[model samples]
Each structure stands twice: as structure tokens, then as C-alpha cells.
Target: MARKKTITKLQILNAAYEVVRTEGFGGFTARNIAKKMKCSTQPIYLEFKNMDDLKNELFEKIKNYLKQEVYSNEHTGDALLDACINYIQFADKEKVLFRALYIENHLGIEKMHKISLDFAMRLMEENEDTKNLSKEDKFELFTKIWIVAQGIASLISSGLLPMNEEDIESNLRDALSDMILGARYSK
Candidate 1:
């Protein structure tokens, strides 16, 4: 009979996530993960079907983390601007993980895109300010906000953008307010 497994799946996944989080997906590999674990990749294989499985699992985790821990529930759909600010803050908290989450694509490249669009759509639906805008217009506007926010987070994470995290954060919040105003008064 095969030797009973010792390491837990959760433990292996945690190690894998840590490896990817610090090293970026390009740097992530079974060999690197094994180095982090101080053991062979056999245990990782045991927990997951293969490298793809592990990669997908990692993406799922980072994706869910972004949705929940980042912007899971906004109490005041009225606070659309505040919600946008909070979204950026979540990225700030988990910048590396966030970047990896947004880029990972075991299924295909567009999968990350769909996930981002879905999140933006949900936020648009919640914000009363954006509620009246046409779907396409609303998506376009929020996509801008999402891109700017992610770029800001990435820049800050990489030390390329330097500013008070708080002060610059307000810029995102204000951008949402401006969008609300634009939507409120259209040509």
C-alpha cells in the first residue's frame, strides 16, 4: 500500500501561494515550491492533480480573496466613491497577490478579464450613481476606474509611485464621484 500522506492539502496550497505571491507567477514552479516546502514536489502532486491544478487552485484562492477580503460587501450602495476607495485599499493590502490574481490564466487569458468585468459589473449595479447609465457606458467608465486603481496599486507595490497612500487614495474616490456627476448630467 502507498505510504499515508502526511502534509495537509491546505499546507501545500499555502506554501504554493506564498511562493507565487513573492516570486510572481513567472517565477513560480514546482521546483521553487518544493524549495519553499523543504521537500519534494511529490507531496504537491499528491495534493493536486498536476501543475495546472495547482496553478488553478492558486488563482481561485487569489480571485476569491480579491472578491471577499477586497470588496466583498459594500454596505451603502450609496457610498460608491467610498467603495471604490476601499477596492484600491484592498489591493494595497495584498498587492502582490492581487497582481498575480489579475494575471493568472490557467484556462485562458480572457478568463482574468471576465472575472474583472464581473466584479466591475457588480460594483456598477450597486452604486446608485451608476445605476442610470447604459450598460456599455457604465462598464467603460468602471473599467477605467478599475484599471487606474490597479495600476496605482501595482505602482505603489513596486515602489515606482510614491505618495501618501491615504492622499492618493482619495483620488480614486473622487474619480467615482466625478463619474457619478457625469452620469447625472449627460449631453
Candidate 2:
């Protein structure tokens, strides 16, 4: 008799991610994950206490993946603009996953928004031009940028816009400039 293969936690989590990537959170299920892994649901249950446990772990992994890949962009002299472009590019590339994460709120929109805000603040600190801004100002700028970036990302992800990189950068710059002006006036 052939021995059954042992599925590791990482293997199960990876398979789950693949399921979410292709089928979105709507399709995230132990059966689907097992199918992706070409295994039975027993392996998934063995690796995770339940679907919720697997889902939480997969959410963490997805966040890390987004931070390292989607949100992490090579600096183009302007760190904020680079981040915006990278975000839009991520939507373009991972349309379904992006929709799941941001559009469908499968991973909890509030948590994702907090993660995005934190990342934006980190980028703000890295930029010499805006590094000295007060915390409140930093937040204002981040919020403005996030609103615009998310809007563009949604449009691109939903097939509503065929946004070119240059156009995205231009829009980001405009939004940044407007936000700076508004912040200065309001202060």
C-alpha cells in the first residue's frame, strides 16, 4: 500500500493562497485548498484547527506578500509616487487578489487600511522632503494619497481604467500637490 503524503502547514497555507489568488476569498475553502494541493481535506484539517485558523494565517501571509511585493516599489526619486505606481501596478497584475483584499473586504477593510496607512507613514519618514512634517500632517498627506491610490487601484482592478504608469504618476503628483496646498492653508 502507498503511504499518504504529509502536508505541512506552509504547504496548506500556500495552497490556500493560490485558491484565493485565483478564485478570490469567496472560494476560500478547505476543499478548494486541498484540491489546489491535489490532496484531501483531511490534510487541511490536520494542518489547521479549522477553516478560520487557516484563513487567519493566510491573511497574514497575504499581508506580508503585499508589503514585500505590491507595496514595495523601487524608489523613483519620489518615494510616495513610487508607492502609488506600485499599488496600481499590483492591481493590474493581481486583479482578483486585489479585488479580494481591497474591493471585497475579505480580509477586513479596517485592518488593511491601517496597514496601508502605516506603510505610507514609513515612506513619508524616508522622504527627506516631508520627513519633518508633524504627525498630524503626515497623516493628512497619507490619507489623501491613500484615497487617491485606492480610487485608482479600484478603477484599474475593475476594468474601468486602463491606467498608464505615467498617467498614474501625474495624478499622484497632482493629488500630492493639492494636499500639501490644502494642509498649508488649513494650518
Candidate 3:
């Protein structure tokens, strides 16, 4: 009978995240992951069907971690504006991780679809009183803010926009306020 490996799946995941966090998706190779683990790539291959399998697992983990790390109830706050700031701050603080988890297409678009929805829903629950909102209204508001904020974040990531410390702070505030106002009902 073949013996199971001693290395945990979590170790592989952590190594993968480190690769992505530091070097982006381009660095997420079996050799790189193996190097980070100081082990042969065979263990990783045995644990996962392939690199795609490992990457898929890492993708789910990234989503869950983002929810817990950046948008959990503790990160939740009393005001809509504060939540927006926190969202922006989370993006800034985890730029490389965010890029790996989000901006990169290695994990494919389906997973990103789920993550985007999860993020929007969290923002809705945190920033707005969902009990006061209709389902249609909730979807609209969430979609609106996410689309715009994601665009801004992408621009920031691409170096297309000014990302100076003060600029990021001020732009985040202004953008959050605009999104809030955009969510207001006129009728």
C-alpha cells in the first residue's frame, strides 16, 4: 500500500498564496510552489489532481479569507461610508493578494462571478439596511456600486489612475459618497 504524504493541503495553499501574492499568477508554477514548501512537486501533484486543481482550491480559500479578513462583521461598521472606506482600504492593503484572487484569470471567470456577488452582498448588508430595501432595489444598488468601485480599483491596479496616499484616501471618500447618493431613491 502507498503511504500518504505528511504535508498538509493547507501548506500547499499557503505556499500558492505566497507565490500569487508576491509574484502574481505568472509565478504560480508547480516548481515555485514546491520551492516554497521545500518539497518535491510530487507531493503537490499527489494532493491535487493538477495545478489547476490546486489553483481552484486556492481560489475558494481566497474568497473565504477575503470575507473573513476584510469584510467580516468586525470589519463591518455602523455607517455606509465607513464600510466603503474599509472596502477601499482592504483593496489597497491586499493589493497583490487582491490581484491574484480577483484580477487574475487563472482561477477562471466563474469563481470570480461568485466572489463578486459575495462581496456586493456583504457590502449591501454592511453599508445599507437591507431590510428596508426591496430585492430588486438591493440588486440594483449592489451592482451599481460594485461596477463603479471595481472599475476604480482596476484603474488603481493598472497604474492608470493617481494612487498617491492622499489621492487614494480622498478618492475613496468621494467615490463612496457618490455611490451612496447614487443608491438613494428619488421617487
Candidate 4:
């Protein structure tokens, strides 16, 4: 008798991640994941208590993926600048995932905001340019840059704006410089 292949929870999660990555959260269902995994939904249900439980775990996984893969670029030696560039690139490259997370709010808006803020603050803490900034100043700077970066990312992801790498980097650099100067002078 041939042994039946057992599907693990990690396998189900990976399948689910691919579904979300390709089709956004709207396609994030057990059936869809099962189709991707070439398995039945029974394995998914057996591994996770419920779809909500799977979704909650998936959300955490997505968050970590974004933090580690999407926003950890160090190309420019400037943490904030690199993060902004990586975010915009991710938005452009992973349009479906970006829309599901930010445009459609599949990820809770407040949680996403907090995650972005926390990540920015951590980068700022490590940056010499922002290392000595007071908490208020840091917040102000982060808000300003985040707004600009988000706007650019939204436009690019929506296909309303077509920008090359140089233009994107230049615009973000200008915005970062302006925000930093404003924060410093306002103190």
C-alpha cells in the first residue's frame, strides 16, 4: 500500500502566503490555498483551529516578511532612505500584496500604522542623522517622511505615476532632507 503524504501546517501556511501574494486577501481562502497546495482543505482545517486562527498567524507572517524582506534594504547606507526606497519598490513590484495590505486594509490600519512607526523609529535610532533627535522631533520627522513616501508608493502602485529608480530616489532624498531640516530648525 502506498503511504499518504501528510500536509504540514507550515506547508498550508506557505500555500496561503502564495495565494495572498498572487491574488491578494480576497483569494485567501482554504479552497484557494488547498488548490495551490494540491491538497484538500481538510489538512488546513486540521492544522489550524479555524480560518480566523490561520488568518491571524498569516498576518504575523506577512508583517515579518515585510519587515525582513521588503524594508531591510541597506543600499544607500541611510536606513530611513533605504527603507523608503524599499517600500516604494515593494509597492511597485508587489502591487497585489501592497493593495491588499494598504489600499484594501486587509491588515488592520492601526496595526499597520503602528508597525510602520515602530520600524521607522528603530531605524532612526540607529541613524546618525536622527540619533540625537528628541522623541517629538523624531515623530514629526517620521510622520512627514512617511506621508511623502506613502503618497509616492500609492501613486506608483495605482499606476498613476511612472517613476524610474533615480527619480524615486531623488524625490525621497529631497523629502527626507527637507523634513530633517524642518525638524532641526523647529527645535
User: Highest lDDT among the candidates is held by which one?
Assistant: 4
| Candidate 4 TM-score, true structure as reference | 0.94
Residue pairs with clashing backbones, model 1: none
Q: How far is each candidate from the true structure, as Cα RMSD in Å?
A: 3.1, 2.1, 3.2, 1.9
Q: Residue-wise lDDT of candidate 2 within 1-187, one digit each (tens)?
A: 9767688899988888998998999889887888888878998887789998988898899889878887777746677788788888988899989899899998899988888888889988887667778899999888888888899998988889886778888888888878866765676
Candidate 3 local accuracy as lDDT? 0.69
TM-score, model 1 to reference: 0.79
Question: Clash number for every model?
Answer: 0, 0, 0, 0
Model with the higher lDDT, candidate 2 or 3: 2
lDDT of 4 by residue, 68-94 (tens): 998997878788999999999999999
lDDT of 3 at 165: 55
lDDT (Cα atoms) of all candidates against the true structure: 0.70, 0.85, 0.69, 0.90
lDDT of 3 by residue, 1-187 (tens): 9887688888999999989888888899999999998999988987899998998898788777766665553322444444444555666667776676567766776676567566666656655445356557667766776666677677776667657655654665676566556556532
**Cα lDDT of model 1 by residue, 47-130, tens digit:** 889988887887787677656766665544444454555565655666665566654443355766676678777767876667
Off by over 4 Å in 2: 1-5
Give residue 100's lDDT in candidate 1 (0 to 100). 66
Report how far residue 89 has shifted in candidate 4, in Å.
0.1
lDDT of 2: 0.85
